[model samples]
Target: MLKRLVSAWVWISTGLIALIWLPWMGLVWLFTARDPGRYSVGRWFRLAAVTVTRLNPFWKFRTTGVQIHDPRRPYVAVANHESLADIFLLSHLPWEMKWMSKDTIFRIPVMGWMMRMAGDVMVIRGDAGSRMRALEEARDRLRKRVSVMIMPEGTRSGGGELLKFHDGAFRLAIETGSPVLPIALAGTRHAIAKGSWLVGRARAIARVLPPVETAGMTLDDVPALREKVRTMIAEARTVLQRELAAAGA
Candidate 1:
């Protein structure tokens, strides 16, 4: 009960901060429209996330297994999705990357506007043509030197374990001839589990594995690469869950 109470207060306080900062963020974006790279809106996002996680002190993060990069090549980062906190955590990735998210989220007032100004791609999931359009948009973004990130699971899993993988992310990487960067995010499930409003102070680990080369790979490679990523994430999830369970508070 006390944990839940503290979590509620934290969420409320964060919401209040967003109410204030989001508008100012929008204004900043407008003034710097031509200089998106000059000012990183991601800094503001990371600050907010770090503040919330640090508020409880117990909430911590650990990352590992990130592959060496060329820094010149564009990649489609594919990962398993498990919670809303995934967004903030993923933003903490080393590179300054853009996201591909649902179209509906881009409709939110200041938040959505900021995302648009940041060169993020919004996709309508159901409409056939919309998916293709989203891919094209992502390719264009990559051509402009932006790495595109997508959650291949599409939606959060019921538990810490991964769900089915969607071929879309893989297909996008293949179509664009960009590398497929596979990441396994553990600990987020315990921090803020799926289908729940409650939050916890558990330390989360986001492990970035090696990137799979997609260049010169045909459509036939998608299925095998997808399975490899899925297995990697599943193993990471199991290891994380066991560690967390053993360290009972």
Candidate 2:
């Protein structure tokens, strides 16, 4: 009981601070921009998130299987969506990656501004025109050697079970000939869950599976490629669940 109370307080406070700080930092980055060679500003934004995570007592992030991300090439990375922490956790990845998030997130004060500055793609769910625009922007980013991270599951899952992924991400990979990086996140469900503020500590693991090359693969190969990605991520999901069970809930 005491642990839950402390966790809630810590999470609320951290959110309030981030609400103010993220936008301020965004404006600062805009007026005093220095590094222009970067296509994705994820590295810089991640540094800020790391500081907050270290100070906040609500929960912590753990990672494994990082050696899979190659620093040399851009990748189209996809992962399972379990909780809001998925965003911050993915930022911890070593590669320079961009997120494809909801269009409304860009309307937020600091968070949205920073996302724009970072070149992250935003989508208005269920709107055909908006989806098309987001797809074009994503393709352009890929062509310029910027890796985009997307949650093909589209939204957070209530049960942590694997959800169906859309064909958009796979289609983009086939069109651009970029390798697809399949990632699986485990244990985040316990950190901050769906429709709940209650928090708890869990041993979260991020597994970056080997990249599935799309170099010679054509549009006709998307179906097979999607199935392969689903299998790889599911393997990691099983490992994560087993680890959680071994930890005794």
Candidate 3:
């Protein structure tokens, strides 16, 4: 219970800090960089998130296999959704990507404003028009050398199992000719369980697998591509869980 309280306090304090920090950074980026959509600004926000996660006493986050150095090679990065903590953990990766988040998240006060300023894409669930626009926006970003990250599961899984993958991300990859980067996350569900507010002590692992090229691929290949990435992540997730268990032992 005390750990949970500490976690809650960390979130509240960091959120309040973000309310002040985001706008100031925005102003600085506007004057100096003149690129509001630049990935560097997004890196600043991600650093703040990593700091918040580090400050929390109940969690230890680690990442591996991230080869995001090449800015010229933008990808359609897909990952499994385990918990809300996955966001902070994944942000630890060295490179920045435009996140495809649900529209409701964009309604939050400071965080949402930061996301918009960072040029993250938003989608309305079950809205066909919104989905199309989001995909179009994602393609545009990829064309401009900005990688886009999506959770193909669409929502967090309660059982920590790989949920059935969605076709939207795969379709986007095929349409844009961007390589599909498969990312696997483990132990986040143990850190902050689905449908629960309480936090627990856990180590989270995020692994970035090799990019699956979509070159010469067409829409008809979306189903196979989706399944292939999904299987890769599932296998990686299992390995990560084993490593985490051994580390704890």
Candidate 2: pairs in clash: 23-110
Model 1 stretches with alpha carbons more than 4 Å out: 27-39, 56-58, 67-72, 243-249
Candidate 1 global TM-score: 0.83
* TM-score leaderboard ranking: 3, 2, 1
Q: Give the C-alpha miss distance for residue 99 in model 3, angstroms.
A: 0.5
Which of the two, 1 or 2, has more TM-score?
Answer: 2
How many residue pairs collide in each prediction? 0, 1, 0
For model 3, the stretches where C-alpha displacement exceeds 4 angstroms are: 32-37
Q: What are the per-residue Cα lDDT tens digits for candidate 2 across 184-246?
A: 998778777788776666557678888889989888898899989988999888997798789
Model 2 TM: 0.87
Candidate 3 achieves a global lDDT of 0.86
Candidate 3 structure quality by residue, lDDT tens digits, 84-166:
88988999998888999999989988888888877789999999999999999898888778889999899986666789998
By lDDT, rank the candidates, best first.
3, 2, 1
The candidate, 1 or 3, that scores higher on lDDT is: 3
Q: What's model 2's lDDT at 88? A: 62
Tens-digit per-residue lDDT, 1-249, candidate 1: 877887788777766666776776667666766753423554454455555555654467766777546544678888778787777677666665678889888887656766776677888978789888888888887786667888988888574556889898888888888888888776676677666778876666677877888878888998997898788778866776677668662
Candidate 2: stretches off by over 4 Å: 1-8, 11-40, 66-72
